[model samples]
Target: MPDVLFAATLTNRATRLDAVLATMDGTMLRRGHEIYPAPFGPDAFVAAFVRLARGLLRSEAREGVHIAGAALALEAVLDAGAGKVVAMPMAADWGAFPLSERLTTASGATSGVAIVSLTDAALLGEMTLGAGRGVTNAVLLDLSRSVSAAFCYEGKLLQRPYLGAIGHIPVPGATWRCACGGHGHLETVASAQSLVRWMIGRLVEAPATEAAVMRLTGGRAEALTAPQIWQMACEGDPVAAELMGAANDALAHVILTLLLALDPERVILSGALAQCGPTWRDALARAIIQIAPPARAGELAACLALGELGPAATIKGALALARQRVISITG
Candidate 1:
C-alpha cells in the first residue's frame, strides 16, 4: 500500500478549509478542495472538516488507496501536551477544544492526526522542503492579516508558550489598536491588513497617491490589496513607497530583535508582504542596513530570504507532519 497522507488548513478570513493529498515525502498528488461560506463556530468547523475528510477518503478508496495519517493547520496556539486548540481568534467558543480526538473519531484515520499552528506548519515546510531546508537554526515569520512567528532551534520547533506572542510586541508612535486589545503592536504597523488600513487613511490627504492607487486597482479604492499597494510603491508612488518603507523598517526591527535572542542563520519571509517586487526588496535591504547596528548590519541584511513555497508552505508543512506521524506509529 502507498503511504498516502492528508492535510488541511483553516483560515478565519473566509471561514475556509483547504485540503490536499500527498505522498509520504510531501509530494502533493492532488491539491485544493476549498470548503467555504460555512459558519466559523467550532461545531461548524468540525462538521465541515469531517465532510471534507470523508470525501477525500471515498475518492482514495476508489483508487485502492488508504490514508495513512493526516494533519490540520490553523492560526491558533495549540496545547502541546493535550493537542487541543488552546487560544484561537475568530471563534472564542473553541476554547481548548479536543480537536484531535473529534477529528480522529470522525475521519477514522487510526494511524494518527496532528494539529499544528499555521506558523509552525509554514516553518516546518520551509525547513524540510523549501528555503530553510537543512538549516539548523532559523526563523520563519508569517506576515498576513496578523503577524505570527515560528522558530527552529537545533532543528526542533519551539513551542508556542515559550514564544509569547511576539505579534503584540509594542511599537513606538503606533496608535492603532490591535485585535488583541493592545496598542502599537508590531502587527499594527507591518501586517498586510493594518498596512492597507493605514494606506486608506493616508489616501484621503494624498490625492495624487490615491489616484495612482485607484488606477492600479481599477478605480476602486476599497479593492486595494496590500500587494497592489506594494506594486505602486515599486513604481514610485510616494505614499505607497513611504508606507512600505516604514513597514519594512518595523519588520527589520522585529527581525533584529529575534536575531539578538535566537541568532538564527536565516530569516525566511512568507505571506502577502513577502510578495513585494525586487525594487521594494532593495528598499527593505536599505532600511535594514540603515537601522541595524553598524557592526552586524551586513550580516543581518544577508539573513533575509523569500520562502520558496510561497502560499503553499503551510499545506506542505501539514503534509510533512502527517508523514512524520505515520512513521512514528509504524516504527
Candidate 2:
C-alpha cells in the first residue's frame, strides 16, 4: 500500500515518471508512492481510476490521491468518487483542460479552481496553500518552459476567496490562434513546445548575423535537437546565442506583463528548459531589468526567483493536490 497515489499520466513520450519523483526529497511525496498511467478518454479512464482508487483505499495511499494532466484525467478522478480531487494544470488542461468541456466545467467551477490570468495573454498556473503551510503568504511560479504558473499560499490555503484569476496581461497582434479560439494568447509564445518550435523556426531563418553562419554550417541547423541547441549555446554558438536572446526576450515580455499585473510577493521559477543553464537565467534576469520599471524591479527582487523543481515540479504539485484531496475528504 502506497502512502499516497498521484494520478499523474505520462506524456505519450518516453520520459520516465519515477525519475521525476526521485527529485522531491523535502516534499511530503518523495517516496513510497505509486503513479498510474491511463490511456485517452474519460469514461474508460475513470473506470480505471476507480480501480486504482480502490486499490489505494485498500492500501496506505487510500488516504489521498493527487491528480494532474488533461481534464479527462480530472473527470476520471471525479468519477472515482474520491473524497477530494486536486486538479492542477499539470499539463495543458488538467482541470477540464483543453477547455473543450466548457458547459460541464462551467457548472462545476466550484468543484475545482482554474488557475487563470485575468489579464491579456498571461502564462502560468498556481495553487493555493493557505493555513496548511502556516505561512502568511506562499507563492510558486511555474517557469517550466512555455507557461508561467503561479500560486498564492497563506498558511495552507488561498488568499483570494473568490474564484477570480490573478495574472492578467494583454498583448495586441499576438497573431496566434489558440485551441481556445482566441488570438494573441500567452501559450502561443510561452509553452515548452512553443519554445522549441520557435527555436526551430528561428534557426531556419537565422536572421541577420546568423545568415552567413546558417549557410556556412551546411544545414547543421536542420539536424539540431533541443539538447543540441543548449549545448551549442553552452559552447557559445552565435546562432544559438541569437535564438536564446529571442526566446528570452519573448519570455521577458510575458514576465514583465505578469509583474505588472499580479505583483506576487515571492515567485519560484521552475521548468526544465528555462532553468537549465546560467545563460537562460542570465537571459531572464537581463530581460527583466531591461523592461521592468526600476521601482517595481526592486520590490520583486526578494519575491522573484526562477523555478528550482526541475521537471518534477508539476508532479510534486500534483502530490500537494493529492494531499489536499485527502484532507478535504476527511474534513
lDDT of 2 at 272: 48
What value does the lDDT take at residue 3 in candidate 2? 35
Which predicted model would earn the best lDDT? Answer: 1
List, in order, the clash count of every candidate structure: 0, 35
lDDT to native, each model: 0.81, 0.41
Compute the lDDT for candidate 2.
0.41
**lDDT tens readout by residue for model 2, 1-331:** 2233333332332122221121112233323223445333333334443444344334434343332211112211121222222243333233433322331243231223222221100112123222112233434544333343434534343322122221223344456664346665665544445545556676555565345334544656454344445556666777666555555666677666656665555545545455455555665777777778887665654454544444444444444444444455445
lDDT of 2 at 249: 68
Highest TM-score model number? 1
For each candidate, what TM-score against the reference? 0.92, 0.56
Worst 10 residues of 1 by lDDT: 31-40
lDDT of each residue in 205-290, candidate 1, tens digit only: 99998888788888888878888888887788898888887788888788888877789998888878787745655666677788
